[model samples]
Target chain A: MENIFRIIVCIKQVPGTTEIKINPETNTLVREGIETVINPFDTYAIEEGVRIKERMQQSGSEAEVTAITMGPAQSESILREAISLGADKAILLSDRAFAGADTWATALTLKNAVKKLEGWRLIILGKQTLDGDTGQVGPELAHMLNIPFIGYASSIEHISGQKITVKRLAEDRYETFEVRLPAAISVGKDINVPRVPSLRGKLKAKNETIPVLNIADLSMDEKDAGLSGSYTQVIKIFTPKHVYEVKMIEGSPDEQAEELFTKLKQLNIV
Target chain B: MEIKVDKTTCTGCSLCKNFCMYDAIEITGGKAIINDNCIFCGACIDACKFKSIEITGIHEKNFDFSAYSGVMIFIEQHEGTVAEVSYELLSEGRKLADALGSKLYGIMPGYELKEKISGIFNYGIDRLYIADNEIFKHNIDDIYSKILVQAINKYRPDIFLGGATSFGRTLLPKVAAIIKTGLTADCTALSIDPEKKILLQTRPTFGGNVLATIITRNARPQMATVRPHVMAKEPVQNAENRQTDNYLKYSDRIEFLEFDPLNFKTKYKLLSREKELGQSINLSDYDVIVSGGRGIGGPDNFSLIKELADSLGGVVGASRAAVDSNWISYPHQVGQTGKTVNPKVYIACGISGAIQHLAGMQTSDIIIAINRDPDAPIFKIANYGIVGDLFEIIPRLIKKIKNGKGIT
Candidate 1:
């Protein structure tokens, strides 16, 4: 009998636009009217996860793909989007306790929720969250789970019954590694191009009810779960002041260079 | 848990001894003996055969966050060369340490770095920590993280800093996970909050659209990875201006981490190490650099950029967009995911400055931007801005330079 794989993918919701505004008094993001989307990198993770399930099924094996995320209730939209992209199940871990959580606390909450799922064969996540740009959660989760982790994986080479091989990316080169089952990998943008959801998949996702888990449901210690448990906190927010004055030279293509040339000569740089 | 060697399977090839960073293993009578200095990094386990070595036992514990003080910078060095980002962090860290009235220490882990130790002291560091061992010859994240965590537990630094390079990005998060602390990545600025006596870690979020200032009020070692070239390097000076005798602190008493070996077991094995080969162009070493972005149009269009660079005796660079479009190889890329260059003069041709691109090169001595769009963010930072097409402007500039009318 073939072993059925239980794959879990983590996703997040981020502002669709780069222009994020913060309320000075609250020091929090002004999210009342902003549009949101699944983090660009998370889409790639979802595509890879769904592809893995389809590949296994074609080979006469059973596999289930579950998409999980930690955020506000509105974040369920991304979970639905994941389901529409072929995820077999969707879970949203949301709670007031999870608010103001940094990467450390966030990873712990997800780790606890994952423990309840039991028998998870593999975990997939985006290389980093676009909103925070921390790239810490996946590695932290892998450490907390005591499993081997491969980050910024560009390709999956082979997968057998209890082993897998992947091409991991570095700054200048790629290194290949083989690891046993029950591992996790964070995929990069280059891994695969995501496919659009079909009409049927979208319809199913729109009607599906996502199960929401809270801190209490995960049986987590209050001291280890949210803002109180977060090791770091934000002190303030402000624009970085420019240290040097910018001198804008106004002119035509030829004239602009001529002006720049004169300035460089005066500065003894030419 | 303890790491034990099986007598029956041990071939005594002496491979384990060669890989141990600490003198924690000795092959006597054709069997490896574990010493007290062993932090259980598991490097020997990966290099062993015959299932001779196995880790047994487990120990769970917590650290007192209030006991740690001082600011420590992880001087990320590889193959005996310290990265430039380390110096930048040192200069910035020096300010933070002074603001808090605490001592500043530098920690370096690598092999064959005896000669480089003096070079680090030139930055005016108070204390220097070096872990010179064979296992540190190449960066293996798992081993390095264990060594770092143990060092933190012993020294109790209130604040820690590292470069946001590939080595630091992978290593620090793992260490933070074990220590149960927070780590802010790719910070653009760092400072100390006087009232709270906490580290202020400011970094960009939301694809570099907004900046968030974070503080580790509860954590002992408030950690951050600052991007290279964003901060200024301390000016080099004579040895008399530096603390020359700080190296004596580690003369005979090397603090090797004393921890249980079983907790550090890892299944990952490094098959090989490939040095970054080829591409003679190192952006940071050049004094003058000319870069092209999507505005350059195509791969062949880069010739204009190269011509300008050649005329000035400088190097040609590219933005991430140009590299992603296959217009040029990644070696020419200069951005957040690419190289952070700190040249004396940086010329941007047709590159609409995205935050990601600007974060990499905003610290240049002088910036010259030539773009058609006046409102492009690149113009705001340009010391000399020209609102024009690069194709038309670059050729005229090249002609003037070649004729020795503008540049001598």
Candidate 2:
């Protein structure tokens, strides 16, 4: 176990779709039937981790990929899904004390879990979760663990001898960086196309027993686990107001085009 | 912290259940029970008319926050050219500083940025802190975060703002974690609460379906990153008027900090940086954008969108459906998962806009929708809408523009 290379992939369970609706009369979110699934971006991270392990195995080395998640009890399903995808082991960090965690607290919780893992080589996570939409957890986790961090990785060029090269996709340019081991990386969706779980893998996932860790199990203080440790607090939540009255252009295709053209000309946009 | 429903006060009303986006509440046996799914967002607490829900254990810590003063903006640049978002942040930072009755400062880390320093002062920055060294030329998360943490400790700023660019998104979180503070990402709005005199950070969450106003009550240096084009950029004073009075005054206040580059060694080594080639046009830079969707039928049909964009001197854009269908690359995608653009005119051809897609481009000045479906959602937000086949309408629009018939 000490000789085997260890890769940890951080995953999350998010709403299956982003098409959330608000009850206009109640001014509240309509959440009765919305389903949850493994975050789409995290699937890529899981795939990349599995690919790294397979690559290592092809080179005649032993490697294992472990998936970890911090969410509610239902989130264990996503962990099992990660196993079906290719992760060798899965861990669920769920507790009532861990609720209401801001990015800082969430990263801190993850850091504690990583420390408990011990002897881990690399950590991978999705660039962001769709629900949170804040890409802060990865870097914050890295800082908490006192390790190097590389983000928005589009591809892994190579991994050899305690070093890994990753291609990062920035806004204006693509940068390639060679980072030392014991580092954390947040990969973008372009990393790889995730494969579907086979029947055998799904059967194995159905029977796999995942260990759940709470704040007490991680040796973390109750105050530092959730809302109490969060540096930021949300005071208000509301839907954005849209006040636009669309003017329909009624006529033939030529007439509609002419009217739009005239309007653009009037506005000095064309 | 602990969140619980006072079952004695709860009337079994499902009002709180509707407010929960996480579906954590269940009405079992005529009582609302908070299950494990609750993230403690407090949305239900607000919805419960009877005040049946409460979150306890949020004990406030006592720290000396009075020592922190002034508002600081991180100046991001590339190849000596300052990013446009930096100026935008400065403009917004100026307002926050004024509301707090404090000075607005700019912190820049780059190599040989002396020439560009003066232009930054025009944005009402009172003092500019410079870290001009060879090691600061390229952005490595480790080195930049260290420099930022050093500056933050030395000059304590109550509020710090940054652009939500690729660099800031990757770098600021590490800095915030190292400094042990709160940093919000992709904030849409920032304002100072008149009573508390704190920075109120507002951002879209749950896939832009809801907006959350956040506050760092217990942390100093409340940090946030704003996306480009989300805020308006206005010079403190006009360029012509500021040249003599404001610029000189601001320039005299510039401070060059000394940082030993040897002390900051990055664990990661930059191998190379290559500019993305082909179809790399930033859609936000264009005043007009012509987009296509799944209705375009196939990838070959995007040539029409490109042609229309070319005729208007704009850039080609695509809806997520089009991009996901492999009609075009992901860079051209305009939606929640893609780049947000607020062009002067956004022409959507054959797109039935989803809420996610509309979140990206709904801010555009003028939106024109052309779709065969008369009830397409794009038309709801569109300033001008056309109900017809885009294939027939686009060619005519492109030909009319190309014929120089509508030009001055």
Q: Pick the candidate with the highest TM-score.
A: 2
Residue-by-residue lDDT tens digits, candidate 2, A1-270: 467889999999887555465454544566547689888789989999999999989988789999999999999999999999989999999998888899999999999899998678889999988878898999899988888888999889999648999998787689999988988999876788899997877988999999999999999987787888899998887776756678999899899888887887787866
The CA root-mean-square deviation of candidate 2, after full C-alpha superposition on the true structure, stands at 2.3
Per-residue alpha-carbon lDDT of candidate 1 for residues A80-144, written as tens digits (9 for 90 to 100)? 99999998889999875676567888889999989999667889998887667788888889889
Error (Å) of candidate 1 at residue B258 is 6.9
For model 2, what is the error of residue B101's alpha carbon versus the real structure, in angstroms, after optimal superposition? 1.1
* Candidate 1 wrongly placed segments (more than 4 Å): A18-33, A54-61, A242-245, A262-270, B1-66, B235-265, B276-289, B309-345, B353-365, B402-408
- Give me the candidate number with maximum DockQ: 2
- How would you encode candidate 2's per-residue C-alpha lDDT over B212-254 as one tens digit per residue? 8999967889999898887888887665333332324555767
Interface RMSD, per-candidate values to 1 decimal: 13.8, 1.8
Top lDDT model: 2
How many angstroms is residue B262 displaced in model 2 relative to the true structure, after the best TM-score fit?
A: 1.6
C-alpha lDDT (0 to 100) for residue B203 of candidate 1: 84
Q: Rate the local accuracy (lDDT) of all candidates.
A: 0.76, 0.86
* Candidate 2 chain A weakest lDDT stretch, 10 residues: A18-27
